[model samples]
Target: MKQIFAFMPTFLLSVIFCNAQKLTATDVNSPEVTVVVDIKVNPQFKSEVKSLVPELSALTIKEAGALSYNYYLSPDGNKILIIEQYKSLSAFQEHGKNLFSGPLGQKFRSSFTVNSIVVAGGNLPDSVGNFTVMKSIGGFNSKCE
Candidate 1:
């Protein structure tokens, strides 16, 4: 039992590291774009924000260029991190336009205050608003089975 306990952390780390994927040259050269957004939910509107995520995700995924759209909430439920991936920069721009203009967008705006945004994998237009831009150095993504 003691021997098993001593090996647990090493075993777990090896399992995790072995499963990790690395980006290939082809992946790096692709026109894919990724965006991560951080927001703070208004205390009074936490429930409203939670309710909106499903609908927002559904609509976002239906876009032809959408690769993935997901949201993660902090343990206290006051913070949200949104990760979005698109086939190309144009696709991401189109999605952005729709996100800030529709009824859903109106509801979303009232629910949270955007804290910051980080864009990676492509050059973005100035019209997209303030954001930190980053180039992919090394990363990996596994395709859905």
Candidate 2:
């Protein structure tokens, strides 16, 4: 028992060291930042935001070096989650420069209180369970058929 106890610490330390080294490598190879935007829309602007979803979708899809672009509306319809991944910092910079410069972007921006926005995982609800119940309740309609 004593031998096992003494060896466990060493084993744990070795494992942690290996993980730290792996994280360093990952940091070096990964993008400068991965932005998770948690946009809280005022109750009055809920419909306005929904109306611009198509334009927002188009803008994000047109971005170069975009890895994953996902937007989700909160169950209460007062907040939005925007998860956008980029290959590099420059890609994000380019996205920002064009986002507010185009007509589509301008129109989309006109509908929001930007200051109300918060970072994802900040002042948000618990994430342990499925945040969207509609996923399970989906497919009731036969639009495809």
Candidate 3:
């Protein structure tokens, strides 16, 4: 009984130490800037915008430190939302300059009658607290876990 007790403590201590020493990547990069841009295109620009999306996506994904670059269309299909992320401020600036004078940019400018273009740098806010957790799942009652 004494030997078993002694072995149990040692095993428990080893497990605790192993779990406590779990290390994560220290070099992971966070979003340098999150650009939430709203672009309104003229009704006639729809075809042009659709044609250019693939080219724009390819160019953006190839850029250095490009994290997430996605564009979404609104319900009316006339408004566009662009969310872009970069690893650092310098990468973002370089991309911005390159994009403005690059072929894709020219195409975009010529195609769309932009109602507004808003570019700002910030991180997206967390919404964990806004979510509700259901206590239990039941019949006819929707439960979220």
Model 3 quality (TM-score):
0.56
lDDT of 1 by residue, 1-145 (tens): 9989999998887667776644444355567889899999989898777679998998798789999999999989999999999998889888988788788888888888999988888344434557777766556664322
Q: Best TM-score goes to which candidate? A: 1
Instruction: Compare the candidates by lDDT and give the number of the best one.
Output: 1
lDDT of 2 at 69: 71
Go through the candidates in order and give each one's C-alpha lDDT: 0.81, 0.57, 0.62
The number of clashing residue pairs in each candidate reads 0, 0, 0
Instruction: Order candidates by TM-score, high to low.
Output: 1, 3, 2
Locate the minimum summed-lDDT window of 10 residues in model 3.
Answer: 132-141
Against the true structure, candidate 2 has what lDDT? 0.57
Clashes by residue pair, model 2: none
lDDT by residue (1-145, candidate 2, tens digit) is 9889989998887766654432222232333335566666766667777778777777877877776677788778877777766666566557777787888666656555443322222122333122321111112211111
Error of 2 at 80 (Å): 1.0
After best superposition, candidate 3 residue 47: deviation in angstroms?
A: 1.6
For every candidate in turn, the CA RMSD to the true structure comes to: 5.8, 17.7, 17.4
Q: After superposing candidate 2 on the true structure, give the runs of residues whose Cα lies further than 4 Å from its correct spot.
A: 1-28, 115-145
